[model samples]
Target: MLDLHHIFAMQKKALFFLLALCALGWGFTSYPTVFAGIAIGACFGTYNFWILVRRMDKFDRSISEGRKVASLGSALRFGSGIAAVAIAITLPEYFHLISAVIGLMVPYVFLFIGVFVSSVRNKGN
Candidate 1:
């Protein structure tokens, strides 16, 4: 099994990179709205990432205990993501929806990449 610490480290790197990218763009554009959007998006992205990590941890625990795991986490994740996007889209005047959306995907992208790397490393053993 892959270490959760390594996974989190990768995710953290992605978060910082994404935040820096947003900050740079905001700085270059001198747009308060862009900064606000990035802030909101980063919050939601981090929230989603933690939720996923928690769910996976719970699943692992359940498996080790020989119990069936529930699927409520998936629904909650989807609902939260949808809500974030909806709010971003509705508040067009305050946030750049595209930037916010991109920010929101940062954690997932990094997590996926981390998983891929881990899988490849294990396969080589």
Candidate 2:
């Protein structure tokens, strides 16, 4: 029931949230530590991104095109989960304990957003 525009909008919001987090880290954390966190985060993000991409590709191949099994919202949720874990791993060493806690929550936020959007669309249909 979800469309491309809905997916894109969610992605845009997520990216903006990420950028805001980065800015907050830069503003509060020391430069060297923030840089290290960024490096670690990027590495983790890249690794997980590839893994999720492969999984999604497999899902796409297995599912019928007419069926909405692995939609873009699902993809975003997966990506956000990966991102949250990455941030949790990367930021704890450099940022405050609270930031790390917030990082851990990112995946759930994305998951809820995805489910809410999907449910709304499905109900509308």
User: Per-residue CA lDDT of candidate 1, range 1-125, in tens?
Assistant: 56766677677777777777766876787685676577567768877877878888888889899999866387777777777778778997877777677767767777788888888999999
After superposition, the stretches of candidate 2 with alpha carbons farther than 4 Å from their true spots are 3-9, 21-50, 59-93
Q: TM-scores, in order shown?
A: 0.72, 0.42
Q: Supply the global lDDT for candidate 2.
A: 0.54
Q: Assess candidate 1 and give its TM-score to the true structure.
A: 0.72
Model 2 TM-score (2 dp): 0.42
Residue 71, candidate 2: Cα error in Å is 20
lDDT of 1 at 107: 76
lDDT of each: 0.75, 0.54
| lDDT value, residue 73 of candidate 1 | 80
